[model samples]
Target: MSDWIILSTALAGFDHAATKHKVLATRDYLARPEMFRGARPNIINLSRSYAYQSRGYYASLLAAARGQRVIPSVETIIDLSARKLYENAIPELEDALNKGLRGAEGEPLPSRLRVFFGTCIDPRLERFGRLLFDWFRAPVLELTLKQGDWVSISKVALLPFSKLDEKGRETLFQAMARYTARQWKDAKSRAPARYSFATLVDANEALPPSSIDSLKHWARIAARMGVSVEPITRKDLPRLANFDALFIRETTSISNHTYRFARRAQQEGMPVIDDPVSMIRCTNKVYLDELMASNGIPVPDTVMLIGPEDFQRAADQLGFPMVLKVPDSSFSRGVKKVASMAELKALASAWLHDSEVLIAQKFMPTSFDWRIGVLGGKPLFAVQYLMAKKHWQIVQHDTGGKPLEGGFKSFSLAQVPPLVLDTGLRAACSIGDGLYGVDLKETNDGVFVIEVNDNPNLEHGVEDAAEKDEVWTRLTNWFIERIAT
Candidate 1:
């Protein structure tokens, strides 16, 4: 069986009809889900009918669920189609759009900040938009926010070049030839050591990939180890089946594409970092509290703040200057430092509006929090994250609400205090062995687990400062081992 197939509205439109790769109608591909699943072919769907509930869309989703490498994986296609999903995106997608339109004041808009919508928008803007989509994984579409309302002027259901002139079409095929040549080699020449893996990352992520420089470094190392690694964004969800394993560098959230990708990748039998179970177990503070408590892991005094009356009991139990957190807070986004009953009441009330209950924990103050990196049930590296200057947490938001982060010092695994490492490993055990960042607070009394993170920051310089390329090489080798076995 061929390794790759193209599912399009019509094969006649494409210039590469003479190529060995199979080109079939989208319906034909949909009709043979079992065949595609058995063959496990990589698919690129060029159907114009990929809107929500469309046959083409569900077929791709079904194929993905059955372990076929279908490009624009159903999850990504659905996410891109739904503009409302980005309404509450981290780093704010809407804010990104606004920033693109209004470059630095008094300076000409950077050439990189362009927007595209078919041929209606300028070519430069189209280039800029494509760059943003490719580089940052920023959600790019025919969207314009006017008067606080989202207005989508167009939909990109099919390849944009369907209407291209003969010359333009030939140019498109030339690009296709180059891409196919690489993919063809990858398909036929994939030795056991040369496993393909896709690392899901976003440019506009809360912790951008560059902050850790993880993607570039990992890809380079993966190549050296006879593995091919691709940096994927939300746009590449459908292409997931092409890889042996998935490493999600993006932050994991339950209500986002990250969760969907984890779930889909798991369903497809791909060994995924931040697996769906890990995401579910790690994202919610409530879950962590129960898991740690049940497993006898040492954690700060914690209780769930359920109602108006429980709030007072929480204060009485944990006392004043407590930490009130939403059940599913991340990177200190929905956490509140309450020093008094009045503050607790107001903050907890506002937080309850978004969640069914809140989490109240005893305030554990320390100069720096310990982050122990655990991969495959073992400690990889350790770091001490100091609180932001004059702030109670590692991240402090400024007047405009952007984050001001604190300094960090990386340490070798052996350098980590034994208790901190042991506690982090114990807490992580309950969640299974994937890449986890276990947050620990070493107090005067004892060390306690703050939380275990599924998609912990693997920032290049900060986490890898001590070991440098060895960090990525070790991580890449983990995936290579998984694929080989």
Candidate 2:
């Protein structure tokens, strides 16, 4: 069978004629497949590759493909395609197809057909070339190309590790090592005699004092490494530009001031730990569910309830013994366990009055849950949190309102079960490359994700004595390394 090559005229808008010629040239090469035995024959060129400098090439290809006199130059086509992809207000490609191939003023123009194909190694293309080989052979791609209309194409592949050639990889690693050494030297040189860190704490919010103490200790450690820390109020955001970094000690939801602080820090190019996007991902249960599910991570059965009707429907679908939770609340504030339809209705009605989005999850009756902390794409630590006696929730406390004895036990990375470690890594990756805490439930069958926290607390004395220092040391080193880079 003849191999197929798909090239997008708009993506290759720079030199339509040249790109078309190249495609045609490459297609002819594939016809004599024996010439290139090491690589696959399927080739795809995206918008970024052709947009570089292929104008005349694009015009000729567009003319031939559409069979019309109107030919769009490479620059114009690239601008249009880029605008469509990045702009929120722009309608989808399907909508454009419905509008027909006419000038914005209604003049008859060429009928454009969007092409999607798979291939390996286009030296002219940058990132897309690196992606081509893996994407073409990917099992998940099921795009059906139309005869003469645009089709959006997407594919799934593991995060590319070997994309950089040997030289590039070695150079990058050496550069990183040199940078770290230089930063450590600079930190030592700039070390303050008695520096302090100031983090902003909300007076109205009831945060655990241990959380604040943890921030203070981290700040002190940063000072030893030549950075000062301080705590400020929300009223002091204007003066926050003076600090190296601002840590929010309070429990922050999506709608809270912590998010605003993070946004401000981002705009000013200041390093903010627990970024706003991270907070948005962690606080919104709907986002968490979709992200984890799409990434093939196993999570408890969860359904988003948009309204009263949807709430009842979801409850019916999940059946009794379901968890109804507010999308943004934590510490079990707005979380309720409903065992029957009546309880579900009452709880849903009560919660709907205050929040627009709610989640109903099939309750996993597990005795223990695992909390895994991930930093820099690696699992830093893991702990098994067993529920209090006769308590279903892992966060529950004893009758005297104290953390139960032996309720929580820390585990080394080697001690965590293979299943929990695997699931935790998947969940962390799904949330993007960042520091996070993944909570997984050990059910009868296997481990399932319960929650993923962006700003996980790292108190000094929280874990086992042997592991606590290691956790703190690793975290501090990671933070310093990131800032230096």
Candidate 3:
């Protein structure tokens, strides 16, 4: 099956003889993203006409919605069509301007810019050029009637498809053909699977839950399971329709791009882990507290820190030494242990600046916290995360700006205490059967549910060490079943 598609109007513009020859030459490797006159599930879209005024743009959007990887995605096409270059690129240009564009001899930039316009240039394009000069401390002149002039100033022109000459059109064709050929060659060599999956992993994240090697290991395991896994970053949001499923290996939060990707994947009917609803439900500690308490799940006594009024009664309601947490905190970043009334008032006031409400829970002291990995409503693996030295939590960021992490010891489901496993499973099942890590504290008193996290850590040597390859195989098998069904 052809994995690449070239969609263009064969009547005009790209219908020229040279352009037609170039497109037809790649016919064996590329087609029109259709199977027997029907649209295929997934294919790389290479269209010549994606202007907002063109029908191709609307068709491309529909194709993208149906899981085709449309080039210059619908969002990109729309954004470009809006022609808000200054609005879109201003944030970057402003910083660059403040730093000042450096000249050859390390001098400041010139004061004037020479500009040119093609036949189909829009007024917005010219205005964009003027705005650039206005922001960058320079003047610009539109060379509407002059050509073939050499100048020291930088030159820019708005060139549309209608103004592109035959040579320019042929150049575009050659570029498309080369790009298509390279994509096909790589696909042939790396992924021979019938379907492709994308794992949203942040390569630049300083402390990603899953390391790059773990992502690679997951890809290798997915390949063995007859699925190709490709690592994608937030920048790949426009191309989300390219894969059969999306596995967000990055941290999941309601206010971040990860949640957006999950939502888009679900809207497109593509199976996605760290599903949007799960992310929304799990990210808010206040919501989790209410959910567990309402469901009769054993959780530490919690009080919603509404304001100073609640603060006066908080210690009496929960305790003096309560754990104050911002609703949407993760990695123990926004959690604080308040040992006294003054401490509670100080920390609560500071945290309240960012969030409207805070959650105060009676601190549960334990040597180690148990994290049970739950997937598909079943217990997968268990780990004991010991508290950081001289710290009350598994992760502690010292005043020196260095992170101190607790040691972890993996345990099989059979080895986990029955009460601990039962409580973790109950709390996780309350949420969807998608992947989760239920944190709990087992003390001499009793086991209590702490929180259920979406997109739980599955590092190579940490969470999956006990299950070995079965961890990835089970996950891949679950994805296959979800996608197939």
Candidate 4:
């Protein structure tokens, strides 16, 4: 049987012509289901009268319905179709490349390719049909397209095109083509290697339960990637010298135990998931803002206040409905939105009784924000954090405003906009931290960076359990790969 025939049999049950066409179109993509599992299927509701002629298109339709990532063989067709690859495709491709291609040994090429295809196909092609339509106008174009860009095409591809000269375009295209071919070749040639790691969760009084939960989830993921995870509490820090690497999971302050642990890990020359510098970054929001702004990253308009008088002056300059946040607090703790100068003064006065420094930032009215998790300087997952009913902060609840019970919804990394990912990557690189979380607020003008946390929580079931599992698994595998090399 032909390859198409075999593929068709693999998707035997669908009878719709459009469905069949989709299946065929997405044939190459079905190799990676985990990458496109969230994609919606394409199903046409045409009357039976129009059925027969569309039969030939059934394969493509089926592929679409099954969330396949079909790529046309010819560059012209791809350009003309303007079908952007699925948002998860590039990351999945990157992940596969990082895992199976780069530094891998003795792995079967075809098997790796099949795995890539199976895990990365998106069934929802029609959602991106408009992109294809636009691309049809320009049948050929050269641009760096990441996986996240495919999910939200308008955010990435629809922007103003660079007016590159012919030579520049050719040079860029050649570079991209070479890189793509090299990645593919590498992916097919390598074998997955495994290693071991250790994590230290400081269960200090101020530590939240989420931190422990994150450690547990990571431990399981480490096990899956053939890395033995030894989760030691704060008391076990002295004995952690035997481990290959050390990850500190706690809310770290400049002079906190977590910070000391990071320092020790750095002293040992270990590949800490979050290094000492990251801990310092996470502890001070002023530092985060400075770094982000210097790097041309998008963040809320913020002014640091060293004292109560400084806060009042900054608040006046920033205007009302501003946010007053402590330099070192997470899960929305010590973050408050003040409406007027008097209220701000009252709040600041109360907070000043406990802390010496604060930040007055322009508050974006949107209650929905995005929390993107970046592992190894790449985005792992993103989730929409919705404020509780009638609340502004994500974790605000009724009893002293604890974390909201049902306000947030998690999305795969593929669901985030490319701009968000770009901003996130920039933030990650600025901190040079391997694992961190970037909180973003989408204002009318553009997205703003709320803050970045070095030891961001990775609770197992907080968002989508399955996606979180995949993130942990992939992260562990990545750690092993890096350690082996």
TM-score of each predicted structure versus truth:
0.60, 0.56, 0.61, 0.55
- Determine the backbone clash count of candidate 3: 0
C-alpha root-mean-square deviation, candidate 4: 21.5
**Candidate RMSDs in order:** 18.0, 18.0, 19.0, 21.5
Candidate order by TM-score, decreasing, is 3, 1, 2, 4
| Candidate 2 regions with alpha-carbon error over 4 angstroms | 1-198, 202-205, 396-406, 464-466
How close to the true structure is residue 250 of candidate 3, measured as C-alpha lDDT?
88
- Tens digit per residue, CA lDDT, model 4, 1-485: 11121123224443334222233222233222233344543221111111111221222222333333222111112122222322223343334333433343542232211111112122232223223322221212222323331221221122111333455334433433332232221112112222347776656545353567667767766766667887777676666557777666666654445655665555445667667656655656655665576567888887766456576677667888899887667677778888888888888888766554467898787878777888877777787778767777766644654345436687776777888878877787777648888888877799888888887767777644537577777667666666667
State which candidate has the highest lDDT: 1
lDDT of each residue in 193-310, candidate 3, tens digit only: 2236899988877667789899899889888778898889988987888788889988887556787788677656777898776776677676577556545689998777656777
Better by TM-score, candidate 3 or 2: 3
Ranking of models by lDDT: 1, 3, 4, 2
Give the whole-model CA lDDT for all candidates, comma-separated: 0.66, 0.52, 0.64, 0.53
Task: Find the 10 residues in a row with the least total lDDT in model 3.
Answer: 185-194
* Candidate 1 TM-score versus the reference: 0.60
